[model samples]
Target: MATPPKPTKRRTYDAAFRAEALRLASESRSTQAAARALNINVKLLYKWQKAVQTPVAAALGASLDPTTAAELRQLRATNRRQAQELEILKKAIAIFSKTDEQ
Candidate 1:
């Protein structure tokens, strides 16, 4: 009997990385070229470009005024960034605490 092949784990990217990748794709000559440079799939690059072009309010189907919607989007982005930073700090603290106890 033949052994089964192992399944590959799906990779997760944070908001910052996706934003930077989208920026690079926009500045590059072609999405394919950008994907090659970033070592990501061309289709994923195209999807990211499409996503960036879509407004968060519209994507969420929100019915707020333009200014409020824009503000909400900015606040959401800031919250995500802060939450990620907090996670990093928590992990760093854990590492330092472990070392201090050794």
Candidate 2:
């Protein structure tokens, strides 16, 4: 009986290279063309493209409007402030609880 061929191991790419590959994949070229240019697998490039493009898919071909950018920046700022406030509250509670135990 003939034995089946073994599958080849997948190559792992560094973060910087992966990011570049994704960038290339995001360009107007076809997946195969991008893969050829980037020296990566077409399937791998497609997967990375899908992962990175999920949120931006709707806006893929369009530029980001100023209002949208401003809203995103505000939301990120608010999130950071809330996180800082929560950390301070947690520290304050810990200090008070320790004082009460003494």
Candidate 3:
């Protein structure tokens, strides 16, 4: 009787490895180009790129230092709020000016 072959286990990538793969793929002309240079699968590199932008990564902010990442989040939120407020003021001014002209 012939012996059965052992099943291969799935490969697990560390955070650093995933980050480097993303950086290389992004810096290149295209993911395909980068994958070719790195000798990794194009689809796998594409998956890593998408994974970095996911909410889970944003929640953890794994790429940057904790303090800097937190500050970035705060600044982005503040800028968004300010932008909305500016839009409202601009619309109000436009409306009031139109009324005055009429």
Candidate 4:
């Protein structure tokens, strides 16, 4: 019986290089042609394209969908505004307290 082949380890790519690969794959005449020109696997090019096109907040490392991400952004904005208002109210209370002691 033939021995089983060893599984290959996954490769890691940097953001800039991955972006370029995706762009080349998308803008090229064909994925096969782009892969050939880049000397990369055609399936790897497709994978890179999907990663680049995914709506992910990479900085936050969050992989939420676009609508969810937009909602989270709006919620954060609202939270910030509310926090500011609360701080102002606390300051006003302190001012009023000082006047009461006068």
Best lDDT among the predictions, by candidate number = 1
lDDT of 1 by residue, 32-59 (tens): 9999998989898878877765566447
Local distance difference test scores for all models:
0.81, 0.74, 0.78, 0.75
Off-target runs (Cα >4 Å) in candidate 3 are 54-102
Clashing pairs in 1: none
Candidate 4 lDDT tens digits, 7-89: 99977778887767766765677889988997878888877655654254555554676587568757866998999999999
**TM-score, prediction 3:** 0.46
* Runs of candidate 1 exceeding 4 Å displacement: 55-102
Candidates in order, TM-scores: namely 0.52, 0.44, 0.46, 0.41
Worst-scoring 10-residue span by lDDT in model 2: 53-62
**Candidate 4 lDDT score at position 18:** 75
Q: Is candidate 2 or candidate 4 better by TM-score?
A: 2
Q: 9-71 in candidate 3: lDDT tens per residue?
A: 977878888877876775677889998887778898878777656485566655777577557
Candidate 4 has its poorest 10 consecutive residues by lDDT at 53-62
TM-score of 2: 0.44
Clashing pairs in 2: none
